[model samples]
Target chain A: MGHLILRVTIKILFAPIILFAFYVQFHGDYGPGGGFQAGVILASAFILHALGFGLATCQKVIPPNWLPAGMALGVLIYAGTGIYTMLFGDNFLDYDVIQPDSHHHAGQHIGIIAVEIGVGLAVACTMLQIFYAFAGREPEPMDDAW
Target chain B: MMLAAAASAEVGSEVTPSTPEVVGFTGAFAVELCLLALLAATAVAMIRMRRLFGVAMLSGIYSLLSAAFFVALDAVDVAFTEAAVGAGMSTVLLLSGIALTAKVEMPVSRTRTIAPLIIVGVTAAALVYATIDMPGFGDANAPANAYVGRAYIEQTPSDIEVPNVVTAVLASYRGFDTFGETVVVFTAGLACLLLLGAGAIRGGGRNDDGEH
Candidate 1:
């Protein structure tokens, strides 16, 4: 429980993991990763902290209350983007009409980024919530007492 | 087909006969074969292992191997997801689940095995049969490659102007489906919260040494 190596390694690795997650999120348009992968990567960093330290410490960093809201807000952001385009007289999720000022390709780029952020938020929060649920449980005592 | 392509590339020091494409395919085939062998070994070990913790760890290894296979198959996005979700998170979650319950599985009754084996065997045979009719992997003439897949590939560069066609298709072309996926994730989180209802059965057994 008091493994210094694990603690130190996690502390060193945590920031870089989150940074890579952000890179994966934004660079997805030009690279292999996207929101789903980025989100899971982000959540894994937090989960690693939870594993090395305790659940309480992890919860202090990412309060349980924030998770559900973050999950909903992400979905809302995605749906809201679609609705915004629709209100602008575009078909559902038709990114071109969202910004009349830019070229249609530019508009598509903007739309993709916006939605990817939404997906990232939702997936990350969902993973954390599931982790909290499982990790927070109290294990029952074993039988065969002396 | 990929093997055939690679084999046809004559190896000559003076000629440099292997095209880049053929060399790439050959490298991919080797990587895939290695990963598959590791995956099979991990699965066999998992089956032989009785401890739930060991099984959980083996499954994580299996996921990592499959992620490598995904990379060899040129599905980097899928590889990324598999490595993160399947290897990273699910293993931790499974260990937690094991912690809450038992570390070892109960021995199964001998009579209960036959029906399940028959069912699984038939399902496997059926799946293998189905694959016989399916097109060879990466065949351009395949039905999957014919219409929608072809359209996505052809249109993504011009229409979305993105280097990553997977992201362009997922977020832009199929935005509605992705929106649905986000909602599904949201609903799953909500369901977990509803079922667990944060702060249930507090301060029970052992105090965890670090338990709040």
Candidate 2:
């Protein structure tokens, strides 16, 4: 029951944070928010969860073993966008060249969004992984337990 | 020819704001000052704290306030990066390091601290003197604004089609720097993994039954 209450409280806190992260990601073009802010905000939610629920439960949700893979995948996703642009016959990171149609503006938007998502994923995962690496050490069992 | 073209480009563009813009500018300036004060307080706290956790938390606050200052300065991308790398990732890593070592930082000795104090004093004085000759905050016609920024703003849209100036500067004009930063992050991760060991065994040991 205590765990259930904690889960509900976390859910309530998490919903707004996720909303803010998305806002930072998309609204960055107009204001002082962007991929980095979104990534940190998203990572903070997980960090808070880990702090409250113990590292073990947090690991169940985001296993430490998969963190490096997630980080690498995020970087690959970001770089892949530039690679895609190059493959499409433009210079690296040339968004317009990726699609090269009348709706080139749309292409730019899509490319930017894709790259931001990649950044957010990489940052969030790396942060959580770091926390796991540091706080994950188990306490030695007491001999008296036997 | 290239020099003439560059000179012409410099003269053609400048960020001249109107009356309402001035009001907005003043508002931003006030916000920037408040954030700077907050950052200073955090730095002071970090320096004064003997507990490692307190110092780590203060450093995170410093990062967050610096991010706010960056936003006020219209460097959104930098603000974002600082908030993530500094406040989010670095704090976590520091705390992790603390977990491996002592929670409380050793108190500074009166005997050993004099050298550091003198060094800090000298550095601060030098920085203050350097700032005196700097162009006034947000001077659109300053050399930094006139040369590199103007060139990028005018030229990058035609080339890259991205509207965000920070994005253009980071991913296009100074792309190599961004790549280097990414490499640094990758290296930090590698170092943590190597020094700390595998992620699974970090927080605690698993039993023979495989329970964490």
Candidate 3:
């Protein structure tokens, strides 16, 4: 964490990792990535930052207090999308009713993107929250000879 | 399902292999074989190593090797998940676990290993026997290939208008399952918070109890 090169490199990589996560998040409709992958990628950026700068600084950037709420909020968004569709008189998660004035294609696209973002948010927050729990436990300093 | 699709696609491409195609397939298979071998080696090393750090490193290597295998199978999405989750995130978690616990595994008694060995051996045998009943790798006439698989492939463009069928199926057709998965992840995060994370906030972040 005190190493200057590692800290500087992590600083450089942080933006790109989050950018890539977003790319994968939105590009799922066309490519081989989706919410889960994007979420993990996003979490990895924070984890890398934590490893380089220590947990306190990482938590300063993404406070632990918000993680649990964020996790729940993601699932709420997903379930809310389903509920919204159901309110339109369709079956649970049926996208055809999402945009009553438009064709099924547009509705499906919109619904899928919304749910994907929900998934990404939930997964990202959950991963970070779990990491915080693990990293928070203090360890006895070990000999570095190994 | 993704693995099945990839295997079938690979088989379909292999059917018309010119010299170049054959060479390419052969080279790919060779790479897969090497990766699998390395994966096995890493697993063995993990088991033999008493040092938790070495075991952690070996397990990360194992995950990376499996990620490579997933790529060889043309399951790029799965490979991405395995690389990120298995190799990347899990490694960090395991290292954190070691920081909380012992750096070396305690030596086990010979008698203590017998039951676990039998259980593992039986499970392995059962899995192998189950595979014997499965359709051959990439068989076009397999039940999955004959039914919903074909439907998804054929109807995705028309029905969902999504270029990625996996996304369409995950987010739309099987939306409930994904919702459940999200909830499960949320629950796990919450559980971790309640178990270990809550203490720090309650204790004003000092951890003065001297317990990990």
Say which candidate scores most in lDDT.
Answer: 3
True lDDT of residue B179, candidate 2 = 48
Clashing residue pairs, candidate 2?
A136-B203, A136-B204, A137-B202, A137-B203, A137-B204, A138-B203, A138-B204
Off by over 4 Å in 1: A142-146, B1-27, B200-212
Compute the lDDT for candidate 3: 0.80
lDDT against true structure, model 2 = 0.66
lDDT, model 2, position A62: 75
lDDT of 2 by residue, B1-212 (tens): 12222222221111111112354557665675576566556665666678988878877877777777666667667777788778776887777677666677667678887776666556555555655566755678978889988999898667556667776666556654654555566566656666655735443453234354
Candidate 2 Cα errors over 4 Å, as ranges: A1-9, A138-146, B1-38, B80-85, B155-163, B172-176, B199-212
Better of 2 and 3 by DockQ: 3
Candidate 2 chain A, poorest ten consecutive residues by summed lDDT: A137-146
lDDT of 1: 0.78
- Model 2 chain B: which ten-residue window has the lowest total lDDT? B11-20
TM-scores for candidates 1 onward, in order: 0.87, 0.76, 0.87
All candidates in order of DockQ, best leading: 3, 1, 2
lDDT of 3 by residue, A1-146 (tens): 75999999999999999999999999999998999999999999999999999988888878887887899899999999999998989988998787767765899999999999999999999998888888877774565545
lDDT of 3 at A53: 91
